[model samples]
Target chain A: MKRFAFFPGCLIPARYPAMEFAIRQVLPRLGIEIVDLEGSSCCPDPIYFKSKDKLSWLAVAARNLSLAEDLGLDVVTNCSGCTATLSEAIHLLEDDILKKKVNDRLGRIGREYKGTTRVRHIATVVRDEVGYERVRESVVRPLEGLKVAIHYGCHLLKPSKIMQVDNPDNPQVMERLVEALGATAIRHRNWYLCCGKACQTEDIPMNMMHDLLTTVKAAETDILGMICPTCFSQFDYGQMKISKKFDEVFDIPPVYYFQLLAFAQGIPYEKLGFDSQRFKPECLLRF
Target chain B: MPEDADRDEPVRVNFRFRRELAQKIEGNLASFCYQCGACVGDCPATTYSSGFNPREIMLKVLYGLEDELLGSESVLWQCTNCYNCHERCPQEVKPVEVIISLKNMLAARGIYPEVVSKIIGTFETTGRTVRITSAIDRQRAKFGLPPLPPVPMDEVRILLEPDTGTDEEE
Candidate 1:
């Protein structure tokens, strides 16, 4: 099994443990091993923290990357925000000047970032490391009739120079992975629009979400498939808020892609924690 | 009437703010923009909010309108940091990064939303954006996951120190 250090950021562990459970359940079965990175903090958040202080953000991110470097393994993150933070840290620390400045801070803490570790989002780990063919072979129950709409989320694919995960404009990583589980992946009209989770303004996120969800609902998909926990929270929990505010009923369930994969791999639906979901993807169990 | 009466006074560019922003990471990427409007087309905030526009923000940045970009009721908070503009910009201006730098400048001036301040406080204390209640562990227990390990805040504190000079040798 290919071993990796797991970096489960704040949201999944605190707000949505189900996504973590799903990742733990599914990755090993596909011949990938995830070891816990003890004492790792938040990716220090990609938005607010970074906006408040870029130097401190880079230092914290570099510290997290150093944990994986010490473990002698590349890091695999379940959350796109964490991936974006760590990945961008790696990209920035490539500059010797910035690396020196950040190291000055890290050196005080008796830790040094040597830029040895590479970070990958779990989606790419499954696509590139685990291979689609292996995922197809591992599936016990095929979601033949289920239609899934994929939400790539912003951080996973954007700032292409930094993320380098997939083609930012026309990404197919999630779609192909969804198809591997025998489900049809539908790309809605507003698929490229962000979930707007980082927008502090109330109306901006509300309206952005309304537009994205309206398209998803129009597509008539059974569930929305996504790889980011932030997007999952926005679409799942934020969906209800948007519906009430817009006076439109949007009943579509938003699911993390790993949960769907775990279900397809025959992990019992009960253990996947769908009960806590605001809009439970009960339709997934039908397969 | 003077021959130059019709001409408006030249706008003064705030070079100090521009220089301070350039010191941050990729903070000066906005200088490359030629008003292509590509970033504006794909920006979610531009689509949803009337006050938030990346092209206009870039134009202001080019002119170094620090008061406009960093003023109270600033529109920078409306940015989603989606990096869609970072992707679509033909000149690779990285408008999102510039906006973040502008936000940092606002933060330096002790100006930011209360929610942002609360999150920063939470992260500074807990090493995580979300507070870890007993219920977080209880929730993890339901999934058979181990309890989260404590963050080494002593080390975190050292990193967070504002003026830890490089000369302090090991």
Candidate 2:
């Protein structure tokens, strides 16, 4: 099995444990190993620049990355928030001047960032390491009839410098990955739209909720496939509020494209972590 | 934003307007504002609502007024995350994402409109961007979903594969 450090970030385990369960059971069959980074905390949620605590943000990011680096392996993450923050830190710390400043602060915690490690999003690993041909070969059940909407959450694509996995304007890697599992990737109005995933705040979210739903409803697809936990939450649970606010019903359920890969692997839906998604058990039937 | 009484010298934020913001819109128009009347002359937001001006925001962001740049309330946020400015820009700037980055930066700072934080907190806690109730119950409601799945406890080690960080004895 291909083994690497796994950072589930705060949400997947806390809010969406089923995704972790599915990942653990499924990735191994694909020749992947996800070692956990013990004692990891929040990605501290990348908005810390406004908070103006670069020291604290770096400390938190270093602490998390240290868990993986100390483990002697680079880190992999499923959440775009975690991936972006972690990778951005890696980029920052890679510079000698910034590294010295961040290291001076991190030294207080007895951690050192050697900068030899990289933080990778799961999609990049799958696309780069596992290869699409391998994914196609591993599929035991193809979702031939399932129509999927792919959400490339901003963090993964934006500033495209750090997370340069696919084309931001026109991305087909995730959709292609979905197609590998026998599912159809649908092009929607909001395919490139932001669900306001990381921009979370009460007044901001409540006010922005309308736009969030407007984009989701505009997609008009059955399964909204996401690769990041932040996007997953916004796209998945935000739907609940959107449905209520707009007074419409959507059977759309959120699924990590990989989870569907597991489902296609003949892994029981129960084992693949489908139960915990926001809408319901039957919601996936539309797929 | 300053308090009522303790007025201090003008504090400058040492930052640059994210190039992605201005280039994505018309005002920064390649960061070469160059007195282009096209922006001031062609803005619909300014024309329709006397208060809205993408040109001003773009100029400020391009000039590197990072704080004053991001400090606007609904101007950038109210910008609709639209690429209209980019399309109209004579110089071709995609300020939409830059505006988004600024908004996200605000949300990150907790300076955003109130609801943005609440929903974000839910995301920080539950791995969701916006959630009303815990999702574990939703899973329980599923008849054919995973059975006896471990509902993750916040304190439980979610990143629990063996850490290579520990010093192993030779």
lDDT of 1 by residue, B22-48 (tens): 877788898898998999888888888
What's the TM-score of every candidate structure?
A: 0.96, 0.69
Model 2, span A1-287: residue lDDT tens: 66789887656765666676677766777788887666666665664331323334555576677778788998988887777678767876766865775566556556677877787888888888888888889887767777777777666775466566666677778887988887778776646555554432334444454554556557776677878776677666777776776677755777776677777877766565566567554544443
Q: For candidate 2, write residues B1-170 as lDDT tens digits.
A: 22222456664433444443432212233355443645544333344345556666666665566556566464554443223454445654545434555564554355665554565455345433334243555553342333222222242222211223431110
Docking class of 2: incorrect
Q: Tell me the DockQ of each model, to 2 decimals.
A: 0.75, 0.08
Residue B135 C-alpha lDDT in model 2: 56
DockQ metric, candidate 1: 0.75
Q: Enumerate the chain B TM-scores of all models.
A: 0.89, 0.49
Model 1 per-residue lDDT at A239: 95
What TM value does chain B of candidate 2 have? 0.49
Query: Worst 10-residue stretch by lDDT in candidate 2 chain B?
Result: B161-170
